[model samples]
Target chain A: MINTEKIVEVQNLNFSYGQVNVLSDVNMSIHLGEFLAVIGPNGGGKSTLVKILLGILKPDSGKVRVFGKKPGTSKSVGYVPQDFSAGRGFPVTVREVAMMGRALAGKGTTKAEDKDVVDKILNDLTLIDSSEKRMDDLSGGQRQRALMARALAVEPEILILDEPASNLDMIGQTRIFDLLAQLNKNMTVVVVSHDLTIIPKYATSVACVSGNVHKHDEAEVTEDMIHQSYGGVEGCPVELVAHGHPHRVLKEHDH
Target chain B: MMELLSFGFMQNAIMASILASVACGIIGSLVVVNRIVFISGGIAHTAYGGIGLAFFLGISPLLGAGVFAVTAAVIMALITKDNKYRADTVIGAMWAFGMAIGIILLDLTPGYNVDLMSYLFGSILAVPKSDLVYMFILDGMIIAYILTWYRQIHAVSFDSEFASSMGVRSDLIYMSMLVMSALAVVLLIRVVGLILIISMLTIPPYMAERRSNSLKGMMIYATLFSLVFSLVGLVMSYFFNLTSGASIIFVSAICFFLSLIYDRVRTSK
Candidate 1:
């Protein structure tokens, strides 16, 4: 049961980094309660598109709206950036990091309600015991979960994550995806991932981004989409191991 | 030490040290966590231009330094906000350019009998009572700033992108931090001199960063460390007839290395 209310709308988006065109003529829309997975090869403007959607980067010529307003003008969106360890070596605890989510949402005061929200999110993430621990002391998986807790602490209507599980192991990746799947039942989720194998299991829809965006209406990754998004490289060795299915999406290339 | 306290000049130096520690503890923690030590050094050196302008205009050097430092900070913030990769090059050039401007301005001034060494290496013993008032006011402002906007500053420092996404005005916060760093540099110039100010702004915070679990804790511990080093270094300078700024920095450096060794030994165990 997908909600038809459009939560994010992008139109004729054109973006470039100092004359090197990244996204051109891209258009996409995300409805309420959508779980959109943005996928592409490196330098394919996957992260750039997410940034533009979050209003972190403005497009050259296009319109991006989140919740019917300009991106970043609304406080209903939470983001977990690709660089999860940006706070490493800094003297900030896990609870403090999560509390930062509430920093901009309301008057900057640590009310008891805000503390309760942070504690609940930390507990949900299984980080209640380490809530007082420094961010530098956490393991990679723990750090990822802590950052996710920060994003969730906002209690946002939409959550956006860029490469949330890039450095995680198989089990760690599965756990993160499971959490996202659980969270998607309530709020809209936008995830940028390079792992093609795991996305089909959780994503409600997929948008293949290269020089432009090709959105699929369902959670299915075809070989043609991968080939098209990867610039149609001849016999590109992109391994798409589909779970709960016996077929490989791409042909096995010999060494 | 009891006898020394009887002297008004010694009392003023101690007051200045305490005020300087407060500024360094708060602002230096931000500087270290943001990894903006080089930017801070650039701002401090650039303040020399202000000192020279003040001498030429027959005004207070600290006033001149404050104006020049804040202006330099704004310019640095603007240039570095978008051009992060080349920030060091820009800051380095500005650092030398400012010193050269100061030298030229001082040379052009008539009847320049000022002891430039005092400004370069610090004469904390000669600090007047008026400067202490300014230092006190600056400390109060820094404290008020932290109390009022601690959460926003924390968010911006930890992750500016996420902060911005959540409507924290991260760019504004970043610029304000740099401006605050410049003001802290101004507050420190009298106690440690321009060249040694960066050391005071970094060493204690760096040591505290390893021991603390929160930014506030880091600031408190850093302030304590800075206070101890200032007192110890002031006493050593009095007894050994040494330069006050250099002695203070020496004390901090010794403690920094010892902390490093202690961490290594404990970690191995």
Candidate 2:
């Protein structure tokens, strides 16, 4: 049963790209302070749904609400997109990028306060050392942290990240998840990841998106569910196997 | 160089170059960082259509180019935003088509003897006082816009998705930036001409990108470099009797290549 203290609510959402249906009658809810993990096969509309929630894309039909407001209208939601470039090779420093997070919050704020907020966030994210470095000069994991620092700098009630640690190593990924876990104590965290190694252990709830959405509060993802999840999608068998084991693929192969 | 200041036209040319650099530096940094050089290029060439339309209607070519460039910007923004795969083909077509329109329009206007070469290259030495006034106002507006919206522009340019999540209108900012690029093209065309506008827009920003650590720094460096290149080229043209526009572009090209060397040498060292 869905809880009453929902931070995000998606009701009867149906999205299509011209002819093909990306999502159909999708329904999901995220409660406050819950670490929600959105997982799915590639092209299963996982990122699309996130984009809709970020107000980057508008759904054809249905509703996506964050904090009782439309996705784009909500200032309390922070986002770190997949492969976020801080204007790569274009002289945007980590500090400057992080400061951009405070641009919208509290009008007519002093520059010193903004700088202080950005500095603390960078320190918390362990990005203070490289705060002065150009975005392109940072390693993938460092860049990912810079993006996270930027998102967290906004001090959002709900922070969403699409494949936040895809560029990071397992150690780096663990550190990020630890950081997310710490943040999730007070703030809601929504992470879109394909890596199943950490999700089963860390996520308070997991939502598997594949044409349809299946939310599990216990965060256990069975191999059968993973296999059956990709049943509707074509040419996803290889990718499914790539992420982990597949019971459905063998079943389909036998057929 | 001493006698250059004695001539009113020379003084005006120097002042115009400084103003042009200001516009180019700010807008050029955005254009480069946003990866919309091709769009700017298309606008530069497509602006010719506006110039031609202006000639046909007996209006100022700058007005026509401004209108035409904005229209081109709208079209470019639409397709490029929705479907990026078709952007190249669309840009290529728009680029040639705009130039062709301008040429045809210039051909149709019988009584006026508009120097097509001047429009193509530049007439920096012949920059009228009225045009400088226009550039001055535009330069002020541009600086103010950047200063007022630097943070928002930073958000949109780097991670628009994050920006939108933070309640910034990334799409509007992006479109506005493209339109501003068109405006920059209009301002620079008289100083450098349509053919060399991209150079003014991209070269300084490209060089400044490596030297600076922030967009503001990049913009400042770009402005300084643009001014230096403009003056150096202007002086070279004045002494050698070369075309001012080509000379400026020549200076930029040289600096670009030299910066490349500097980057390589520093990296290797």
Q: Tell me, by TM-score, which candidate is best.
A: 1
Off by over 4 Å in 1: A107-110, A219-255
C-alpha lDDT of residue B185 in model 2: 90
Residue A19 miss distance in model 1 (angstroms): 1.5
lDDT of 2 by residue, A39-153 (tens): 7777888999998888888899998998889988877877887666544686778888787777765432788888888889899988899998888889888888888887777
- What is candidate 1's TM-score against the reference? 0.94
lDDT per residue for candidate 2 within B68-181, as digits (tens), equals 998899888887886746798989999999999898988898886988877789878888898898888878888888988887898788777777777788878888899889
Cα lDDT computed for each candidate against the true fold: 0.86, 0.84
Write down the C-alpha DockQ for each prediction: 0.66, 0.68
Clashing pairs in 1: none
True contacts kept of 1: 0.73
**lDDT at residue B68 of model 1 (Cα atoms):** 88
